[model samples]
Target: MGAWSKVRRVFTRDANIVTAEDLLSLAREDRLGGRTVHVTNDSALRHSAVWAALRLRADLVSMMPIDVYRQVQGLQVEVPKPPVLISPGGSEVGIKEWMYSTQFDLDRAGNCFGIITERTGVIGPDGRGLPGRIDLVELGEVTVRAKGPQISKYKICGVDYDPWDVWHERQYTVAGFPLGLSPVAYAAWSIEESLNAQQFARDWFGAGIVPSGTLKNTSKTIDRKNAREAKESFRAAVSNGDVFVHGADWEYKPIQAVAQQAQFVEARQFGMGDIARFFGVPGDLIDAAVSGSSVTYANISQRNLQFLIMHLGPAVGRREDAFSRKLLSNPRYVKLNTDALLRMDPQTRAATIAAQINSRTLTPSEARALEDRPPFTEDQYAEFDRLFGSRSVPTPPPTAPTGATS
Candidate 1:
């Protein structure tokens, strides 16, 4: 087992890549009042000083040295900073009374890191695209890491979303396996949590808690029951768009693939069961058993995700996170000769699969659905119609009826 297999409960995976420039753009798109990192560094905004600032509260301001002030654009947007007071002598109300002194200076990235690192933190992918721990730099010499978060900052599929309030905001939505999971308790009451429990008993069916034959039969029985439960989950998430039903093709392929190979899901289940037992929280709500550093209350979360992936299938790219319009065309997963391999390698397979694809045909409805989406332009549409008649597949246009008619 890898470290991930040890506790097997908590972990982060990077699917979101927001660069410094990207952050600046996002800030601009929001029409921020702060123009530069410097002006934004005011104590009130806390951009230059705090360990973390919510997107709603903070704005990225670019900073300029006295010499480079002219080169920086967008100076008009800088928000006004609050006044900083001077604290001096024993006569001062307090020795370090000026809260401004503790805040950050936007001109200094080092100081900015110091403040944010001390507050909330950022996690991202290492060069390898795996989840690396979150850390902030201090004075360009020291490193400060996120102790633990008070929210859900991890990227899923490919989006970074922190949409909840209260439990997911102040502290990590699920944290401190030993601390009793600050707000993980609320998840226990969620519909998703109960589904995890149902899936759990099914995964354990063949563990041989009973006679061999009985265990096999019991496992099958459990699987059958779980299937209906799983479908209920699928329908709920789909209708709600938590998991989408892509037309008919790509929608549930990932889910089916995951179900077929839910071996990873099973091991993960046992891991969470152990964690729940350790913490005395309900197993359905908390899964603390991590392969290594994965412990905490994310266990149930992981299981719920497994169930989703088991039904929806994994995806790639930004919009890929939400079930796309692709799935409705091929709901089940299949290989090159089959169906439901998400986003086939358009480049490499274009030639080889062309022959295989051309051999098959589609019905009127299927053919129409295959039409390339518009803004393909009227000219492009006419060209295709001229060539392939009505089919979207790449076959040469039908030979116009000899010399018969116009």
Candidate 2:
């Protein structure tokens, strides 16, 4: 017992070392009926629906730009992005890649962790230095221990890290729980069902347990040796892709496996919908069919808006809040521009922009910025005036007092 304790202490103290026992303890396995299905982070990704849902959310969030803003004079103004926001994982990993990695982990495991590798000289209000670079750690390697509503320790690859030294974000949280609830863990049953169906299909086809058809002698009874000889001859001919010559007494009928195949396919489709629900993704977004209901959108923008409001909005908001608290100081916050996801077709976007400009809700310059164009120069304005008249509204003739105005 003393020797085992010493061995355990040595493994825990060394960050670079690991044992087979530690890895086996961390691996997740689900036993359904008589079979065991390994449910690790990588194995969960084998399911197509899980892959599509995670990819959709991660790709969308990563492409959207993240900006920092400061509150000044009761209004928010955009500020220069810090180093962390620009290249969080270092020069090789841009903000997009970093965001994608973190969002993927958050969607799958309901939490993400990173090591704060670099810090700026500027200190936040909490007396802690601001992080300049954060390198994300794999979810499998991290083990978290927490007190009520607070994390007590983080173990990554057998080494302990202080909570302050680690960057952590969580979603799908419950009251009095320090760690978030994992979608993958909750949907393990559905995943196992799908995986089992897939394996059965593979085995059914690969092993050739079910023959295409059966042969029988109708004219007279055949001896066991003759029957075996006939079966072997027929199999050899079929395997060689040649026709077997036989007498009229023998009959062959082909069988179709359509019904059997369809059963497993339907099971897979149902599993797809269940997985989509677990990840807060729309079934149609991942091409999974939803039964008995058809929804149509006037435009893609409206569809995107619906998804944002109903599903993705709260998650995005939570992420922004996390970023603000961990990466910025007081009075400064972070925002992920969701306009990228709400982009419409050219015609609809043009009409929307024109309407906003006409209603004085959006300026022409601001509209141009949205389209990634610079404001018109003097020469360009002159050319526009030559083709079309000046855009400025005309002034009315001088009027008398309000009571006498005509």
Number of the top candidate by TM-score? 2
Please, what are the lDDT tens digits per residue for candidate 1 over residues 63-116? 110010111363423222111111111233221221122112221121222111
Model 2 steric clash pairs: none
Off by over 4 Å in 1: 1-374, 391-406
lDDT of 2 by residue, 135-245 (tens): 898877787655446666788878899888899898887776566667886677787678867866765566543336778889998899999999899888875456889
Candidate 1's displacement at residue 272, Å, is 14
Error of 2 at 329 (Å): 0.7
User: Could you say which candidate leads in lDDT?
Assistant: 2
Off by over 4 Å in 2: 1-36, 210-262, 389-406
Estimate the Cα RMSD of every predicted model relative to the unseen true structure: 28.5, 8.0
Question: How many collisions between residues are there in candidate 1?
Answer: 49
Clashes of 2: 0
Candidate 2: C-alpha lDDT: 0.80
TM-score of 1: 0.15
Cα displacement (Å) at residue 257, model 1: 46
